[model samples]
Target: MITVTSRSELTQSDSAPDPTAEPQDGTVLFEGRHHHSGVTFFWADTPPGSGPETHWHPYTETWAVIEGDVEISADGETLQAATGDIVTVTAGTVHRFWNTGAENLRMLCIHASPELIEHEVPQD
Candidate 1:
Protein backbone atom coordinates (compact mmCIF):
# COMPACT_ATOMS: atom_id res chain seq x y z
CA MET A 1 0.00 0.00 0.00
CA ILE A 2 1.06 3.55 -0.76
CA THR A 3 0.38 6.47 1.56
CA VAL A 4 1.35 10.11 1.18
CA THR A 5 1.42 12.58 4.07
CA SER A 6 2.46 16.21 3.90
CA ARG A 7 4.05 18.39 6.57
CA SER A 8 0.79 20.27 6.93
CA GLU A 9 -1.02 17.05 7.77
CA LEU A 10 1.66 16.14 10.26
CA THR A 11 1.93 18.49 13.25
CA GLN A 12 3.24 16.30 16.00
CA SER A 13 6.97 16.43 16.68
CA ASP A 14 9.10 13.97 18.58
CA SER A 15 12.04 16.36 18.68
CA ALA A 16 12.83 19.93 19.69
CA PRO A 17 11.60 22.17 16.87
CA ASP A 18 8.01 21.92 15.76
CA PRO A 19 7.62 22.32 12.00
CA THR A 20 4.05 23.46 12.44
CA ALA A 21 5.17 26.01 14.99
CA GLU A 22 7.76 27.66 12.71
CA PRO A 23 6.56 26.61 9.23
CA GLN A 24 9.72 27.05 7.15
CA ASP A 25 11.99 24.87 9.24
CA GLY A 26 11.85 22.43 12.12
CA THR A 27 10.81 18.87 12.76
CA VAL A 28 7.72 16.77 12.23
CA LEU A 29 6.69 13.28 13.18
CA PHE A 30 4.61 10.85 11.16
CA GLU A 31 3.10 8.26 13.41
CA GLY A 32 2.67 5.15 11.34
CA ARG A 33 -0.69 4.01 12.66
CA HIS A 34 -2.13 7.44 12.00
CA HIS A 35 -1.13 7.18 8.37
CA HIS A 36 -1.89 3.50 7.95
CA SER A 37 1.76 2.57 7.75
CA GLY A 38 4.01 0.06 9.47
CA VAL A 39 6.72 2.39 10.69
CA THR A 40 6.91 5.67 12.56
CA PHE A 41 9.13 8.39 11.11
CA PHE A 42 10.65 11.69 12.13
CA TRP A 43 12.03 14.33 9.75
CA ALA A 44 14.26 16.54 11.83
CA ASP A 45 16.21 19.67 10.89
CA THR A 46 16.38 21.38 14.23
CA PRO A 47 18.73 24.09 15.43
CA PRO A 48 21.97 23.53 17.27
CA GLY A 49 21.54 22.13 20.80
CA SER A 50 18.08 20.94 19.84
CA GLY A 51 16.97 17.31 19.91
CA PRO A 52 14.82 14.75 21.64
CA GLU A 53 15.29 13.93 25.32
CA THR A 54 16.02 10.54 26.75
CA HIS A 55 13.40 8.08 25.69
CA TRP A 56 12.95 4.57 24.41
CA HIS A 57 10.55 2.27 22.61
CA PRO A 58 9.69 -1.40 22.67
CA TYR A 59 11.01 -1.69 19.13
CA THR A 60 14.34 -0.84 17.58
CA GLU A 61 15.04 2.67 16.30
CA THR A 62 17.50 4.13 13.85
CA TRP A 63 18.74 7.59 12.97
CA ALA A 64 20.21 8.59 9.64
CA VAL A 65 22.10 11.83 9.89
CA ILE A 66 21.85 13.69 6.63
CA GLU A 67 23.48 16.97 7.68
CA GLY A 68 25.35 18.56 10.57
CA ASP A 69 26.44 16.50 13.52
CA VAL A 70 24.81 14.67 16.40
CA GLU A 71 25.87 13.25 19.75
CA ILE A 72 23.81 10.36 20.99
CA SER A 73 23.64 8.78 24.41
CA ALA A 74 22.15 5.33 24.51
CA ASP A 75 22.23 2.85 27.34
CA GLY A 76 25.10 4.66 29.03
CA GLU A 77 27.15 4.69 25.86
CA THR A 78 27.93 7.85 23.94
CA LEU A 79 28.13 7.93 20.17
CA GLN A 80 28.68 10.58 17.57
CA ALA A 81 27.34 10.73 14.04
CA ALA A 82 27.75 13.19 11.22
CA THR A 83 26.35 13.68 7.77
CA GLY A 84 26.06 10.45 5.79
CA ASP A 85 26.07 8.42 8.97
CA ILE A 86 23.48 6.13 10.49
CA VAL A 87 23.07 4.93 14.09
CA THR A 88 20.82 2.34 15.60
CA VAL A 89 19.60 1.78 19.12
CA THR A 90 18.23 -1.59 20.08
CA ALA A 91 14.77 -2.08 21.54
CA GLY A 92 14.19 -0.73 25.05
CA THR A 93 17.47 1.16 25.10
CA VAL A 94 17.21 4.60 26.66
CA HIS A 95 18.52 7.09 24.16
CA ARG A 96 18.70 10.79 23.38
CA PHE A 97 20.58 13.02 20.96
CA TRP A 98 21.80 16.57 20.70
CA ASN A 99 22.71 18.71 17.71
CA THR A 100 26.44 18.99 18.27
CA GLY A 101 27.13 21.25 15.33
CA ALA A 102 27.08 24.99 14.81
CA GLU A 103 24.33 24.69 12.22
CA ASN A 104 21.07 22.89 12.06
CA LEU A 105 21.22 19.12 12.27
CA ARG A 106 19.09 17.19 9.83
CA MET A 107 18.27 13.54 10.31
CA LEU A 108 15.69 10.82 9.80
CA CYS A 109 14.40 8.90 12.81
CA ILE A 110 12.77 5.59 11.97
CA HIS A 111 10.96 3.41 14.45
CA ALA A 112 10.25 -0.23 13.74
CA SER A 113 6.66 -0.15 14.82
CA PRO A 114 3.32 0.77 13.34
CA GLU A 115 2.60 3.17 16.19
CA LEU A 116 4.90 5.57 18.00
CA ILE A 117 5.25 3.84 21.31
CA GLU A 118 7.68 5.79 23.49
CA HIS A 119 8.69 5.64 27.11
CA GLU A 120 10.52 8.17 29.24
CA VAL A 121 13.60 7.41 31.29
CA PRO A 122 13.00 7.80 34.98
CA GLN A 123 14.47 10.84 36.62
CA ASP A 124 16.49 10.84 39.84
Candidate 2:
Protein backbone atom coordinates (compact mmCIF):
# COMPACT_ATOMS: atom_id res chain seq x y z
CA MET A 1 0.00 0.00 0.00
CA ILE A 2 1.21 3.47 -0.90
CA THR A 3 0.43 6.42 1.26
CA VAL A 4 0.87 10.12 0.63
CA THR A 5 1.92 12.70 3.14
CA SER A 6 1.82 16.42 2.66
CA ARG A 7 4.35 18.81 4.09
CA SER A 8 1.67 20.66 6.02
CA GLU A 9 0.48 17.48 7.71
CA LEU A 10 3.95 16.39 8.70
CA THR A 11 4.62 16.61 12.39
CA GLN A 12 7.80 18.06 13.76
CA SER A 13 9.48 16.67 16.83
CA ASP A 14 11.78 18.53 19.19
CA SER A 15 14.65 16.24 19.99
CA ALA A 16 18.19 17.02 20.91
CA PRO A 17 21.13 14.85 21.71
CA ASP A 18 22.27 14.60 25.30
CA PRO A 19 24.77 17.20 26.45
CA THR A 20 27.08 14.49 27.67
CA ALA A 21 26.59 12.53 24.47
CA GLU A 22 29.48 12.22 22.06
CA PRO A 23 27.56 14.08 19.36
CA GLN A 24 25.83 16.85 21.33
CA ASP A 25 26.09 19.91 19.14
CA GLY A 26 22.84 19.74 17.23
CA THR A 27 19.10 19.36 17.40
CA VAL A 28 16.94 17.24 15.12
CA LEU A 29 13.41 18.08 14.11
CA PHE A 30 12.13 15.06 12.22
CA GLU A 31 9.27 16.31 10.11
CA GLY A 32 8.00 12.86 9.27
CA ARG A 33 9.13 9.37 8.40
CA HIS A 34 7.95 6.27 6.54
CA HIS A 35 9.54 3.03 7.61
CA HIS A 36 8.08 0.62 5.11
CA SER A 37 9.64 -0.26 1.77
CA GLY A 38 13.08 0.44 3.15
CA VAL A 39 12.62 4.15 2.66
CA THR A 40 12.68 6.82 5.34
CA PHE A 41 12.08 10.49 4.67
CA PHE A 42 12.36 13.31 7.17
CA TRP A 43 13.32 16.90 7.64
CA ALA A 44 15.93 18.16 10.04
CA ASP A 45 16.43 21.66 11.38
CA THR A 46 19.65 22.78 12.98
CA PRO A 47 20.06 26.11 14.67
CA PRO A 48 22.90 28.44 13.89
CA GLY A 49 26.27 27.25 15.13
CA SER A 50 24.92 23.77 15.70
CA GLY A 51 24.84 20.70 13.48
CA PRO A 52 25.70 17.07 13.28
CA GLU A 53 29.25 16.08 14.07
CA THR A 54 31.39 14.02 11.71
CA HIS A 55 29.60 10.76 11.17
CA TRP A 56 28.29 8.38 8.54
CA HIS A 57 25.48 5.93 8.01
CA PRO A 58 25.18 2.39 6.84
CA TYR A 59 22.69 3.24 4.11
CA THR A 60 22.68 5.63 1.18
CA GLU A 61 21.44 9.05 2.16
CA THR A 62 20.41 12.16 0.30
CA TRP A 63 19.82 15.62 1.72
CA ALA A 64 18.19 18.60 0.11
CA VAL A 65 18.68 22.00 1.65
CA ILE A 66 15.39 23.72 2.35
CA GLU A 67 16.63 26.93 4.00
CA GLY A 68 19.71 28.69 5.30
CA ASP A 69 23.16 27.45 4.43
CA VAL A 70 25.07 24.37 5.48
CA GLU A 71 28.61 23.08 5.27
CA ILE A 72 28.89 19.43 4.29
CA SER A 73 31.99 17.46 5.01
CA ALA A 74 32.57 14.26 3.15
CA ASP A 75 35.43 12.20 1.82
CA GLY A 76 38.05 14.52 3.36
CA GLU A 77 36.54 17.53 1.63
CA THR A 78 33.97 20.15 2.53
CA LEU A 79 31.34 21.84 0.47
CA GLN A 80 28.96 24.68 1.26
CA ALA A 81 25.37 24.10 0.29
CA ALA A 82 22.65 26.70 0.18
CA THR A 83 18.91 26.55 -0.22
CA GLY A 84 17.75 24.28 -3.04
CA ASP A 85 21.00 22.39 -3.01
CA ILE A 86 21.09 18.64 -2.76
CA VAL A 87 23.79 16.32 -1.48
CA THR A 88 24.18 12.56 -1.54
CA VAL A 89 26.29 10.25 0.56
CA THR A 90 26.79 6.64 -0.32
CA ALA A 91 26.78 3.89 2.23
CA GLY A 92 29.89 3.76 4.45
CA THR A 93 31.00 7.22 3.43
CA VAL A 94 31.96 9.60 6.21
CA HIS A 95 29.91 12.75 6.32
CA ARG A 96 28.64 15.51 8.58
CA PHE A 97 26.73 18.76 8.61
CA TRP A 98 27.43 22.26 9.96
CA ASN A 99 25.02 25.14 10.19
CA THR A 100 27.29 27.91 8.98
CA GLY A 101 24.64 30.55 8.59
CA ALA A 102 23.05 32.82 11.16
CA GLU A 103 19.58 31.39 10.74
CA ASN A 104 18.47 27.82 11.14
CA LEU A 105 19.46 25.25 8.55
CA ARG A 106 16.61 23.16 7.26
CA MET A 107 17.12 20.07 5.15
CA LEU A 108 15.12 17.16 3.80
CA CYS A 109 16.86 13.87 4.33
CA ILE A 110 15.98 10.58 2.67
CA HIS A 111 17.49 7.26 3.55
CA ALA A 112 17.39 4.36 1.12
CA SER A 113 17.11 1.65 3.73
CA PRO A 114 14.93 2.06 6.80
CA GLU A 115 16.53 -0.97 8.40
CA LEU A 116 20.02 0.49 8.29
CA ILE A 117 20.11 3.01 11.08
CA GLU A 118 23.60 2.65 12.45
CA HIS A 119 26.19 5.35 11.96
CA GLU A 120 29.39 4.42 10.19
CA VAL A 121 32.70 4.65 11.97
CA PRO A 122 35.53 6.83 10.78
CA GLN A 123 38.07 5.00 8.67
CA ASP A 124 41.17 6.54 10.17
Candidate 3:
Protein backbone atom coordinates (compact mmCIF):
# COMPACT_ATOMS: atom_id res chain seq x y z
CA MET A 1 0.00 0.00 0.00
CA ILE A 2 1.12 3.52 -0.72
CA THR A 3 0.40 6.58 1.44
CA VAL A 4 1.34 10.22 1.16
CA THR A 5 1.24 12.88 3.88
CA SER A 6 2.15 16.51 3.71
CA ARG A 7 4.10 18.35 6.39
CA SER A 8 1.06 20.52 7.20
CA GLU A 9 -0.96 17.48 8.15
CA LEU A 10 1.34 16.62 11.03
CA THR A 11 0.23 17.32 14.55
CA GLN A 12 2.29 20.05 16.09
CA SER A 13 3.93 19.23 19.37
CA ASP A 14 5.10 21.55 22.12
CA SER A 15 8.68 20.77 21.24
CA ALA A 16 8.19 22.13 17.76
CA PRO A 17 8.44 25.79 16.92
CA ASP A 18 5.17 27.68 17.04
CA PRO A 19 4.66 29.56 13.81
CA THR A 20 2.19 31.80 15.59
CA ALA A 21 4.85 32.80 18.04
CA GLU A 22 7.30 35.51 17.12
CA PRO A 23 10.88 34.63 16.32
CA GLN A 24 10.18 31.04 15.40
CA ASP A 25 13.19 28.90 16.16
CA GLY A 26 12.56 25.62 14.33
CA THR A 27 10.03 23.05 13.20
CA VAL A 28 9.17 19.38 13.47
CA LEU A 29 7.41 17.29 10.83
CA PHE A 30 5.79 13.98 11.59
CA GLU A 31 4.38 11.20 9.46
CA GLY A 32 0.61 10.80 9.18
CA ARG A 33 -1.70 8.04 10.41
CA HIS A 34 -0.69 5.84 7.52
CA HIS A 35 2.53 5.06 9.39
CA HIS A 36 1.47 1.94 11.22
CA SER A 37 2.59 -1.17 9.41
CA GLY A 38 6.35 -1.61 9.54
CA VAL A 39 8.38 1.55 9.37
CA THR A 40 7.80 5.30 9.24
CA PHE A 41 9.72 8.21 7.78
CA PHE A 42 9.51 11.89 8.81
CA TRP A 43 11.38 14.96 7.72
CA ALA A 44 12.73 17.77 9.90
CA ASP A 45 14.62 20.93 9.13
CA THR A 46 15.84 23.22 11.88
CA PRO A 47 17.47 26.55 11.58
CA PRO A 48 20.81 26.94 13.28
CA GLY A 49 20.48 26.66 17.06
CA SER A 50 17.16 24.81 17.04
CA GLY A 51 15.91 21.26 17.28
CA PRO A 52 13.73 18.80 19.18
CA GLU A 53 13.68 18.68 22.93
CA THR A 54 14.56 15.68 25.08
CA HIS A 55 12.23 12.77 24.51
CA TRP A 56 12.17 9.00 24.31
CA HIS A 57 10.33 6.47 22.25
CA PRO A 58 9.33 2.86 22.79
CA TYR A 59 10.79 2.06 19.37
CA THR A 60 14.15 2.76 17.79
CA GLU A 61 14.68 5.84 15.67
CA THR A 62 17.42 6.61 13.15
CA TRP A 63 18.34 10.03 11.88
CA ALA A 64 20.03 10.64 8.57
CA VAL A 65 21.57 14.06 8.47
CA ILE A 66 21.09 15.31 4.96
CA GLU A 67 22.49 18.82 5.37
CA GLY A 68 24.30 21.08 7.85
CA ASP A 69 25.36 19.95 11.32
CA VAL A 70 23.65 18.71 14.46
CA GLU A 71 24.58 17.92 18.03
CA ILE A 72 22.91 14.89 19.52
CA SER A 73 22.58 14.35 23.24
CA ALA A 74 21.77 10.85 24.33
CA ASP A 75 21.58 9.52 27.87
CA GLY A 76 23.85 12.38 29.06
CA GLU A 77 26.82 12.78 26.77
CA THR A 78 26.62 14.85 23.59
CA LEU A 79 28.28 14.46 20.23
CA GLN A 80 28.49 16.59 17.12
CA ALA A 81 27.31 15.17 13.82
CA ALA A 82 27.47 16.66 10.38
CA THR A 83 26.06 16.15 6.95
CA GLY A 84 26.22 12.56 5.69
CA ASP A 85 26.17 11.28 9.24
CA ILE A 86 23.59 8.86 10.56
CA VAL A 87 22.58 8.78 14.23
CA THR A 88 20.64 5.98 15.79
CA VAL A 89 18.83 5.96 19.11
CA THR A 90 17.79 2.70 20.63
CA ALA A 91 14.33 2.22 22.10
CA GLY A 92 13.62 3.91 25.43
CA THR A 93 16.76 6.04 25.35
CA VAL A 94 16.31 9.64 26.42
CA HIS A 95 17.69 11.99 23.82
CA ARG A 96 17.53 15.33 22.04
CA PHE A 97 19.21 17.03 19.07
CA TRP A 98 20.06 20.54 17.98
CA ASN A 99 21.39 22.26 14.90
CA THR A 100 24.76 23.70 15.81
CA GLY A 101 25.98 24.77 12.43
CA ALA A 102 25.56 28.08 10.62
CA GLU A 103 23.07 26.72 8.14
CA ASN A 104 19.66 25.08 8.32
CA LEU A 105 19.81 21.42 9.22
CA ARG A 106 17.87 18.88 7.20
CA MET A 107 17.34 15.29 8.28
CA LEU A 108 15.28 12.21 7.58
CA CYS A 109 14.05 10.41 10.71
CA ILE A 110 13.21 6.74 10.32
CA HIS A 111 11.23 5.01 13.01
CA ALA A 112 11.12 1.29 13.60
CA SER A 113 7.43 1.53 14.41
CA PRO A 114 4.63 2.64 12.14
CA GLU A 115 3.39 5.29 14.51
CA LEU A 116 5.04 8.06 16.47
CA ILE A 117 5.12 7.67 20.22
CA GLU A 118 7.09 10.13 22.29
CA HIS A 119 7.57 10.73 26.01
CA GLU A 120 9.06 14.08 26.70
CA VAL A 121 11.48 14.69 29.51
CA PRO A 122 10.07 16.92 32.15
CA GLN A 123 11.78 20.20 32.87
CA ASP A 124 12.93 21.11 36.34
Task: Give the alpha-carbon lDDT of every model.
Answer: 0.82, 0.68, 0.76
lDDT at residue 28 of model 1 (Cα atoms): 73
Off by over 4 Å in 2: 2-37, 120-124
> Across residues 45-66, which tens digit of lDDT does each residue of candidate 2 receive?
6789877657777778999899
Q: Per-residue CA lDDT of candidate 1, range 1-124, in tens?
A: 7877777776545332333454444777777777788898888887998777688899999889999999999888998899999898999899999999999999999989887788887767
| Backbone steric clashes in candidate 1, count | 0
By lDDT, who's the top model here?
1
**Span of 10 residues, lowest total lDDT, candidate 2:** 10-19
- The lDDT, on a scale of 0 to 1, for candidate 2 is 0.68
Could you tell which candidate, 1 or 2, scores higher by TM-score?
Answer: 1
lDDT of 3: 0.76
Error of 3 at 56 (Å): 0.5
Once fitted onto the true fold, the runs of candidate 1 whose alpha carbons sit more than 4 angstroms away are: 12-25
Local error of candidate 3 at residue 108 (angstroms)? 0.6
Question: Which candidate should be chosen as best, given TM-score against the real structure?
Answer: 1
TM-score of each: 0.84, 0.70, 0.77
lDDT of 2 at 120: 42
lDDT of 1: 0.82
